[model samples]
Target: MNQHVIRPVRADEWEKVKELRLAALRDPAAPVAFLETEEAAVGRPDAFWQERTEGASHGRSARQFIAEAPDGTWNANVVVLVEEAGTVGIFDEAIDVDQGHLVGVFVRPEQRGSGLTEALFEAALEWSWSLEGPALDRVRLFVHEDNARAAAFYRRFGFEVSGLVVPMPTDPSAKELEYVFPRPAAN
Candidate 1:
């Protein structure tokens, strides 16, 4: 049995981050589950990976959590990006509140059914709700309509359809549905 530990990535772990991201892009569901391609990711310079890892690891506005196997290999990851009101997002949607946008979610095939996904999201959501400045009102993620596995997982995790649809940037004919987990009401 492999012991898996869930935690945030360190800023200096850029090499590992790059390695895991490449692996994710190679997964069969990459087409609909991820926004980047293996070809593009592999072509990126080391500086880009370094900057990306640094920002996500140390930046207050975003964070990346990874599941480390007993042998020290990262087999899964999830990232949350904080968006403030009036900002334009990657998909051209205008942010209407202080929200956390979940993205870059991936888990290795061997680790898929081991509750790793749930652990990763719990960490991401914990960090999002714990942000001190400009408290978040909700957390959101867009799932490709054809990716039923991912959609089912999100639904099982308490995310509900937000009724906002956006055309896939790479394939305008395809659509992605938005799902949201609203913050619980104050006691």
Candidate 2:
């Protein structure tokens, strides 16, 4: 709830980006909230971070945003994966939906209940809706079915389950639920 600023990721801040990602992976909920483990993330070389940030930062459709505290640490982050029309894999790939896939959403525990999540969602979805040409029809995110707290939060934020379940890529036995928020008709 402090005066943290949310903005698109800067091209040169790959180091901070890497640091924040590692920090998120270390969070207690990382098992359910993130796909990559701390070991996997920390093992990546500097080159990976450089390319990752450059690609998303300069991309026409996808983008990453961070909430930075005044002391220069990132309090939270969100990445919007844009799925253009006629594209598959946007929402479960097999379904072929025109939408924006929201992923890699994380907020530090200290910042969890201070409206930061909602603000981050607002920024990510706003960016998704503002895409030109083929407008994104919906915005969606995947949440582990076992993560009840996350599910509750998503529901409060206006996302409803699409009833589409996908196995976790890392652990095929577990299923993750897909939640979606359709773009407002008048918007």
Candidate 3:
């Protein structure tokens, strides 16, 4: 396994962020794992990328973490979004409590099974639980029903199926399942 450094993305690393996202969109599992298309992402302007990076990098309500290889290449990334109570979530469900929503998870083919994914989630969950003003009650993620690989990984990470399923916005014939990691019990 290659050595990697896992860290939160910096606001100025918009270029690297954009590059990694585009690469993710090109992966074979992208269609089922991500809502965005490579075409849409490629058509976006630099300003959009800059704003996105800034929001995830500097905003208190969200964060994007990346695993950088020894040579400085980003091989994996995950974004966590804070959902406040009483708000509508990405799946159109009402948020019942303060929570963290994990999204945009991707690891390069070469880095899969190297423990990078676990490390990324560890950092994200730690950050979510450590928030002071509005601590999260749980961290959640949506996985397409057909993406068994992702679902298994999530389950292995202690995220249980929440029994809430939603139709894919772009393709209602398909569905996504909600998985959640409830806040760990206080020690």
Candidate 4:
């Protein structure tokens, strides 16, 4: 377990970002943790990666952070999506929650339990909390029901189940649970 410097994704590093995403998709837990498959990701064009990375990294509505090991290898990543007051969930329910939706969470298996995940979460949550007044009141993430490791990590990080479960769009027969961490009013 090495110390990884967690920082916002750089605009010029889209290629590396694409590589990490594809690697994550190839992980054994991809079926439960990620919607994208290796085959599908590998088929994407360079422009897609460039646009996706630039938009996500520099876009005001969202932010993506990456963890890079001392050797220059990416160890993990997390992206935060800001949900506005009148937005709606994938299920079409009004997204009155006004929250930060965490997505694209991944930690390389070799780096698991090295505290890098916690550091990544801290960086992400700090960014989410740093938003302007009335920007975002809470942070939420969906965890597949069978991904107990992720659920446990969320709980350890002070997140609690919101009692909302949505069937995964990629696999309607499967379900995922939404966990949330409300920002303190004083934040």
Candidate 5:
């Protein structure tokens, strides 16, 4: 729904955060769209979810945004993690430039094809580019190569493949392709 509010997740909403994640992991496309399974997430201690929510809830290094229905339900979420130049990143690889990596992407099945994903990215990109003290160069995401639907959406959203391939952690034979939203030129 267009009325759905898009905003950053708050520190105190860990329970809601965990709830949405579990739902996301249970989606049929979850296997390719998410790294964690529902079973694994369900077994994690509450503290882990709390700490995770708290960390991303308030920080320049990471931010998680959600689309909340008017009824107070969180139907979708995405996290943008900052990767500073020359620092180690989530991929356990060296970072070449400052950037924002979008991860933990999820949209409720009922909410798909509603333009909600674009709204979420609009918020994320707005935040990413608005950061000061040496702004980031670009925003990027990795999509599983086998997930054709997602890859198509990313392309339609203006994210171009950067020619980088990441080996899947669970199945090295599979791969993830990097896509980036090019930085806007100075106005």
Candidate 6:
């Protein structure tokens, strides 16, 4: 079980965020699990990470959550981006509903099966469904078809295939399947 704290990344933690991301990019699953390459992430400037951290830390539309070990290491992380209905999606398509899109999911190899990823996701979903003004309609994630381990975990976590598929940005011949956790029915 994971006893570590799961919380949003702070504005000043860009270096730690970068470190965790780089480590994640080196994981064996990274090739199919992430859209960006380690080489690309390593080449980004400090300013890019700083700005990205700042935005995620304070922005209303996006947040990055981390599972921090007692020793202060970030063991896992997940980022959620709010897509407003009628807005352009990250893929440049139209977003038909207000929703949260999970991305940049990673868990350190040592933390695998230790419940850290679930803790990270609970924090993310709690944050997502709690957003006010105009509440989100659902939270969705895309998994590479080849990443069966990830997709199976997502199913166990309550996300269901949304019957939509899109070409992976890195390989047009490969596909990414959409899964969603719609806002829980009103209690």
Q: Relative to the unseen true structure, what is the Cα RMSD of model 5?
A: 1.0
Candidate number of the best TM-score:
3
Q: Which stretches of candidate 2 lie over 4 Å from their true place?
A: 85-92
The clash number for model 4 is 0
Query: Tens digit of lDDT per residue, candidate 2, span 66-115?
Result: 99899988999999887765656633455355688888888989898988
lDDT of 4 by residue, 73-105 (tens): 998999998888888975555798678989889
For residue 159, model 1's alpha carbon misses the true position, in angstroms, by 0.2
Which stretches of candidate 5 lie above 4 Å from their native place?
A: none
RMSD of candidates 1 onward, in order: 1.0, 1.7, 0.8, 1.5, 1.0, 1.0
Q: Candidate 1, which segments miss by more than 4 Å at Cα?
A: none
Which residue segments of model 3 deviate by more than 4 Å?
none
**Residue 54 of candidate 3: its Cα lDDT?**
91
Better of 3 and 5 by TM-score: 3
lDDT of each: 0.93, 0.86, 0.95, 0.87, 0.90, 0.92
Candidate 2, pairs of clashing residues: 89-93
- lDDT tens string, model 1, 6-89? 899999999999999999999999999988999999999999999999999966788999999888999999999999999998
**Highest lDDT among the candidates is held by which one?**
3
Question: Positional deviation of 173 in candidate 2, in angstroms?
Answer: 1.5
> Per-residue CA lDDT of candidate 5, range 132-175, in tens?
87799999999998899989999999999999898877677888
The ten-residue window of minimal lDDT in model 1 covers 1-10
Residue clash pairs of candidate 6: none
Q: Work out the TM-score per prediction.
A: 0.97, 0.94, 0.98, 0.94, 0.97, 0.97
